[model samples]
Target: MITLIRVDDRLIHGQCIVRVLADFKIEKIVIVDDFTASNPVLKNVFLLATPPQAKSVIFSVEETKPNLLQFIENNENVLLLMRSPTVALELFKSHPQLKMELNIGPISYRPDTIKVTSYTYLSTEEIEAVNEIAERRVRVYFNQTIDQKIIEWNEVKNLLRSG
Candidate 1:
């Protein structure tokens, strides 16, 4: 089963491999990104970053659509990683049977993006995508590491409303 679905701009980096994998006891890390799927060099870089014990694989959204259920429905604990809320939203939309918890990890600041939390920044479209995901009954939270305090979906909504 998919243990966690995370959105981080830097997908499958040191922090993700070290913290999330170990803490969650994840058996596999499935990265769904078009760019990484198509670029062998980038895919190898992400794969190399992961430890030997953990299974790491990269698949584009389209590549995953047909066989996503088979990939995630197994008994093994899997962590689904995506680089953006847009992609995460798309994946969730395509595979509605996925886990309900959507964790928002590091989102690099862009000029047009607003800081929702210390680690998360979002553009207007991203904000809308997040809202749409929540509307689908998926709970979204901001978490960097497992030990940190979680910022729930309502808090993000409040931040967007206040800002």
Candidate 2:
């Protein structure tokens, strides 16, 4: 069972190791990213960042479809981390049975990307990807810290569509 599902540009960072995982008591972290999975150096960097007790596994988008079910079955309290909203949308497409609200975390600003909030940014493609996911009824919210108010995906989507 996936205890937490987060879409953060920085897959495994200080916030993730020190706060997110600790807050949720996540024992296993499954990072679904094509680039990180294929690159050894990046994969090791993430591994090093993870807490000693918390196991981290990086899988390409293609591999995740086949492996996600097994991973979820093995660990009841797993934190599912994706590099971007697009990746999370892809994962949801492949594994629709995994019903969990998506947490829109830090999506760093990039060229031509619209800043949804201080912590969230979206390129045209990223916005479209998120819109598709939201259309599927996957609740997306922007909440960096536990106390922050949840910003609904529909609100953001409408803003993007209108602007």
Candidate 3:
């Protein structure tokens, strides 16, 4: 089952391996991203970065639609990490059955993206994509680590609309 779903640009990093994985007892990490899956070098980097004991799979958004259920059905705790809210929104669209709250991690500062929160930022398209998900009643919150304060999506959305 998916114990945690996070959108972190850095993917599986030190904080992820040591904090998120350990706290959630994540046995596997399913990274849903087309760019990462298409590039073997990048895929290998993510695989190598994962701790030896934990299994990791890099699947394109399309590939994940069919296999996501199987992964969830398997008797193992899993952490589903996406590179962006856009990707998570895509996954949720195809697999509506897989309903879980989304944890917004590091969105990373980009050239044109607006800073919604310290670690969460959104571009024009990203904001719309996230709003689509929020419309579906899926809870999205900004949280860097297990200890960080949770910032609700509505609060962030209002901030975007105002500024």
Best by TM-score: 3
lDDT of 2 by residue, 12-69 (tens): 8877887888888889999999999999999999988888878898889888888888
Query: Would you list the C-alpha lDDT of every candidate in the order shown?
Result: 0.88, 0.85, 0.88
Using alpha carbons, what is the TM-score of model 3? 0.96
What lDDT is reached at residue 99 by model 2?
66
Candidate 2 runs further than 4 Å off: none
Query: Model 2 Cα displacement at 110 (Å)?
Result: 0.8
* Reference-based TM-score of each model: 0.95, 0.93, 0.96
Put down candidate 1 lDDT per residue, 5-70, tens digits, no spaces.
999989988788789898899988889899999999999899898888789889998987886797
Per-candidate total of colliding backbone pairs: 0, 0, 0
Winner of 1 and 3 under TM-score: 3
Number of clashing residue pairs, candidate 3 = 0
Query: What's model 1's lDDT at 136?
Result: 94
